[model samples]
Target: MKTADCDILILPGLAGSEEDHWQARWASRLPTARIVVQDDWHAPEPEAWRRRIAEAVAAARRPVILIAHSLGVVAAVEAAPDFPPDVVRGALLVALPDVEEAPDLPDSVRAFAPLPRDPLPFPSLLVASRTDPHCAYARAEDFAYAWGAQIVDAGDSGHINVASGHGPWPEGLMRLAGFLKTL
Candidate 1:
């Protein structure tokens, strides 16, 4: 499906994406895209994050296409089963953080631990970075496999965020466009 035909929901990671983050840039460019505002970003509660995603999807006027990064990816996956069937057409999941195993993350992330292994209900693509501090590349592959999502190796791309120097992320936009075409 074309972008214009879907509601693109941009779900940012912990503390939310900065103004220069790719998600934020894309939200400005993509006519139908909007960020799903979380009630709290500093210390995430898994159930609240999951419920928020479900609520966003439930309210979409058109078929939903999720653009999620880091913790948002986990929340989206956690909320998958709650979504009304077929309401979500697809998802572009990037930089999935290892909430279960990452030692450096805050303790609160543990609430989202033991990541769900069920296949997502919609078509999806997971873009993973080999050097992301939050998750191991192999683990990202595992997530993609479990979710039945096509995996793209973004070699050495640290979390694919602004700090990693992906402010505009034109390449990501191209990849998203390609994914949309397949739907």
Candidate 2:
């Protein structure tokens, strides 16, 4: 199924994607896209995040396509088991933050130490940056392997957020569209 044929659910990272963030820009550009709201974008409760994502997937009318960034990527994995595989066609997982090693990491994130590594039941892509301060390239690849997702290199993009200057993120949107076409 084409990406345009599915319900695009964008999940932002810790602190949430700002108004001008790539995720926000994509939502405006895509006629049928919406953001999956976490209970608290700041506090970051794993179970709450998981439940919110699961609920969003459960309510989806069409095949669901997930676009997640930063800690939201982890939450997506946590919610994966509850998402009936038939409804969730694929995901664009990106910018995993190292909650384990972030010295100044919030208490909420550290609480999620020892992330899950089980392979995902659906087709997905894991996009990572070489210079992301939060996570190493090697670790991102490891996640891709464990989650059974195809890895995509995003060069030196910093967490792929607005802070890194990915305002419009036209390229990322095009790439997402390409992935959606394959679904």
Candidate 3:
């Protein structure tokens, strides 16, 4: 589906996507896109995050497409089942953090552990980094397989965040456009 034909929901990870983050930049560029704000970015609550995503999808006037990063990927997938069926056309999941096994994640992030393995209800693509400090590449592969999402390997891209020098991330926009075409 064309971006103009759908509501693009941006879901940022812990601490939220900064102004220079790719998600924020994409939001500024995409007219139909908007960020789903959480109550607490520093300390996320799984149920709250899930409910917010579901509500965002439900409130959308057009078919939805999710663009989630890091821990937001976990929230989006966890809430996928709760979304209005058939309303969400697809999702672009990026930098999925290994909450279940990553050793350095904060205690707050671990609340989203035991990541949902059930296949997502809608078509989805997961963009994984080979050198993300938060998650192992192999584990990301496992997540994609479990979620029934097509995996895209991003070579040595550290977390694919602003800190990783992905401020504009035009490549990601191209990828999203390509994924949109498939839907």
TM-score, per-candidate, Cα-based: 0.98, 0.95, 0.99
Candidate 1, 1-183: lDDT as tens digits: 899999999999899988999999999999999999999999898999999999999999999999999999999999999999899999999999999888788888777988999999999999999999999999999989999999999998998999999999999999999999998
Q: What is the lDDT of residue 43 in candidate 1?
A: 89
Q: Which digits, one per residue and each the tens of the lDDT, describe model 2 over residues 4-110?
A: 68898898878888899988888877877899887678888888888889999999999899999888888888789999769889999988887777566788887
TM-score of 1: 0.98
Model 2 scores a C-alpha lDDT of: 0.86
Candidate 3, position 58, lDDT: 98
At residue 60, give the lDDT of candidate 1.
96
Report each candidate's C-alpha RMSD, comma-separated, in the order given.
0.7, 1.3, 0.6
What lDDT does each candidate get? 0.94, 0.86, 0.95
User: What local lDDT does model 1 show for residue 112?
Assistant: 90
- Cα deviation in Å at residue 24, candidate 3? 0.5
Per-residue lDDT over 99-139 for candidate 3, one digit per residue giving the tens place of the 0 to 100 score:
98999999889988889899999899999999999999999
- How far residue 100's Cα lies from its native spot in candidate 3, in Å, is 0.6
Best by TM-score: 3
Candidate 3 root-mean-square deviation in Å: 0.6
